[model samples]
Target: MKKIAILNGPNLDRLGKREPEIYGHTTLADLEASLRAEFAATTSLDFFQSNHEGALIDKIAALADAKFDGIVINGAALTHTSVALRDALAGAHLPTVEVHISNIYKREEFRHTSLTAPVSLAVISGLGLEGYFAAVRFLLKR
Candidate 1:
């Protein structure tokens, strides 16, 4: 089975709690279920979430061996900062799709800038949970 890695960073574990109005009431586990079903016949995915920068980087580093065919990453708040994560992803050299629940451009000025998007094959934002599925489908195409 072709495998994909779904890496979420920073505060994603608090998805439903941190911003219910924006991120919706879907828990991380619930989202995983949705992603699993969405890609059931298409791809097998390993979903991981972390709040620490180093842990997130570790996940990226550990995947450097090409164990996964592609990646769907929601860098969360790290998208705007984290040069280390950017470097790790660049080193991985795998097709990557980045998603955000809320429209970062429309939110805080700080959220307007993303250090990671430029390196991603595609970026999906302002689409809520559906964006995740969009990313899954995108990976399945490749």
Candidate 2:
């Protein structure tokens, strides 16, 4: 099975309860369960969520060292601001897809820019949780 790491950053831990209107009502655990159910036969999914940037960076490095096949990351707020996170992704040299639950272009001006997208193989936005599935499928095919 393909090994994929799903990394979520910052306030994503509050997914279901945090602005249900924009992010929808799916909790992080719910998302993980759904992804597992959807891809369990073909992919081994590992999940990590962190409110701290260093934790995320460290996890990415660890995933690289462990030879993970791909990464699906929802950097949340850090998507717009963290060059360190972007660097870590680039350095990992793994196939990566960046996922955003909401459309960043449709949000605040600051969100229109993603520091990590440049290092990602693709960016999935505005498609809600389906974006995560799409990302995993793409990576699996790759």
Candidate No. with top lDDT:
2
lDDT of 1 by residue, 1-120 (tens): 778999999899997888798899999999999889877887888888989898878888777685788889999989998999898899888889999999988899999998998889
lDDT of 2 by residue, 1-142 (tens): 8999999999999999999999999899999999999999999999999999999999999999999999999999899999999999999999999999999999999999999999999999999999999999999999
Model 2 residue runs over 4 Å out of place are: none
Per-prediction TM-score: 0.96, 0.99
Residue 14 of candidate 2: its Cα lDDT?
Answer: 98
Which pairs in model 2 have colliding backbones?
A: none
Query: Candidate 2: minimum summed lDDT over ten consecutive residues — where?
Result: 101-110
lDDT, candidate 2, equals 0.97
